[model samples]
Target: MNLLGRGALAPAVPVFRVFGAMNARAPSASLAPDVASRTALAVHNIEVVYDHVVLVLKGVSLEVPEGSIVTLLGANGAGKTTTLKAISNLLHAERGEVTKGSITFYGEEVHRLSPNELVRRGCIQVMEGRRCFAHLTVEENLLTGAFTRKDGRAAIQADLEMVYSYFPRLKERRRSLAGYTSGGEQQMCAIGRALMARPRLVLLDEPSMGLAPQLVEEIFEIVDQLNRNEKVTFLVAEQNTNVALRYARYGYILENGRVVLDGPAEALRDNEDVKEFYLGLSATGRKSFRDIKSYKRRKRWL
Candidate 1:
């Protein structure tokens, strides 16, 4: 069956591109004036601190234009998840807080909003690990995402069908307990649940985690479909650089809590450093683990 349905066209507006970290002195110059007006989210020189002591993110800044797919690429412990949590206002739950800088959603400062308040304003996070309620049936798990909505059942039911349309597999297993489903299905359930909230911006953390390559492709394909047809904006934090770059229009690379490099996806894909380090391919040939490890010490961005 066709999951994307009709009216799925490529985004009309060009993605606003920013390279390197935004200059603290000239932050306004990072994005073109026209493009800035269309931004869905903007994080400016933000710093995240855990336990009021350990710093996690340092002066990281980026933008996600409305109706576009943006990817955050990095290895484990690179602050990718922390950045998403900061944007979603989920940091307080873990004793983390944004100590500096500002975050804005749709041109309004939102760093101080509560998590559920953020959800009510149409921004939500589909957390890592597909955190589904294990005992809840698949459909029930999806319904939980709509808890903040005051819209009548008719509207909610229409959206439920819309979520099922994007994920027919969810419809097939609607009665099955979420814990009994496969990893891929659980990932779908997580994303489907976010859709039930009728979100405008979905912060997706590691959607490909623990899934097979084919399943990863399926998950990303669904994300693309949602962006194209439903006009949902996505900010995906992923470790799989190749796949993320293939689907995202723009990307930011994080390391040690700092944004070291960022640009249009095609530019990043062909970049020498990205090809050698992230893609495991150098001008000579594919490198072994030992070669990559040796090259890591001299990463140009460092």
Candidate 2:
């Protein structure tokens, strides 16, 4: 079954339609790695314009190394999703156009490639919402992701089984309509569907959104597992800074559509400005309150 012909399995949401801007700031050194550069994907000075006038992305730049997890963190309308769209070249409706900069994938320039071509060339995106077919069964949805391939039935079947292995709940509901499943299960189905394409780099957008805390943890664990075990690189855009930072080896902080900060995950985790602003930590008395409480407890005990 040709997935595109049926339209039943077509990606419902536009793959990428990123827009918006972030606040301006200086780049910090703690975020930059000292080791030799290794970029699986690089977005260099890219600018996106809507309707050939209003600009959304402003000179955004970041890199994802081979076999590692990198995250883009920002608030809503920070152009996180737009950045993904620029990579996939699906910037329609917003009349979104990339006027400046280029996106390179695996050392090849991707800004000129068509959306379908990009998918065929080893890059696939698992969109923000769990946009699985509400009427289709889980098995059908997974098969749809592989529509671009012309492999034998046996290989597709094996891959389908692998998806089930990674997400057992998807197997349990293989025959069930996607709409009937819970949010987390739908998310699993979405990711499983993307994996069917056998991508070299997976662009994950807000995979943890709308799930419970436990489910969020599970999702991040799966992401980490894919990077470690499958050796598939990832560039994820997430609103949940803590979860993304926890799993990502490197991170880029976007503010007003620009790369405000870029660095290793550990450094972003400990940065004072990042903690105070992006992570919403109180810089003035973050530990002071805890220390004061501890001292009071010790005095009473003594």
Candidate 3:
């Protein structure tokens, strides 16, 4: 007779219980192997205040592993940029303070370091609006980023070539005044300047803002390539969720100075709540998928 009570239904209760226990044990025996760890940059609970009266960041926490691109998504005045500034220590420059919590860069405290000190230690920020010296030549603007280095001229020249390789258009405008180039070209220059610092992580603020569609695509492509090939980490603050999510490995959604949602890029792409709010989708609309697609087409044209 089978132990499963096949013959005359012998001890049906005991046989079924034994089979169930064996089934559970089989899966436990075939468990997946352990995974090697990935290097991660951790941001603990951090808070920022402006002028000792107004608060910006409130108990924000996130992480970016090595060789990953992270994005902070938010609408206007949502403290996304403030979080980037706090991470890079730019808030201290403006007398805006980290009133609470500590920041660790590669497991070391970063809140106490000066901006220049941080740059030397491999962290840099490319501010919003592509702030470049308009009258300066492209080469000069790039040279400014290497002021901290005492290396000889040939090494600096090699670094410039590497930057130009990443942004070929910047090489085409190498001798022109930054003011004379188009908006996209200026943004490239700003990023190239940041790269000259030889930073492991670059805090980019609104890199896609105020640019034409083609240029925005070009810039995002470069950022993606850097993360893939150069192993450069990124923490970008962007209003354009569609573009930012395309390049980021992970993302955090900020609203009114608080992190309301955060997860892997693939997860957020499918999240209904993120689509409704940050991705600018109509949560209650009854439009069909075709209609939604048509609406997005119109938005791109506009």
- In terms of TM-score, the best-performing candidate is 1
lDDT scores of the candidates, listed in order:
0.84, 0.77, 0.75
lDDT of 3 by residue, 112-167 (tens): 88888888887899998999999999989999998777777888889999999999
The best-first sequence of candidates by TM-score reads: 1, 2, 3
Candidate 1 clash figure, as a count: 0
Model 2 — which ten-residue stretch has the worst lDDT?
1-10
Best by lDDT: 1
User: Tens digit of lDDT per residue, candidate 1, span 34-58?
Assistant: 2533788999999988777677777
User: Candidate 2: how many backbone clashes?
Assistant: 11
- The TM-score that candidate 1 achieves is 0.87
Please give, for residues 68-129, the per-residue lDDT of candidate 2 as tens digits.
78899976666788888888887764478899998999889988888778988878988888
lDDT of 1 at 151: 93
Cα distance off (Å), candidate 2, residue 140: 0.8
> What is the lDDT ranking, best to worst?
1, 2, 3
Error of 2 at 200 (Å): 0.7
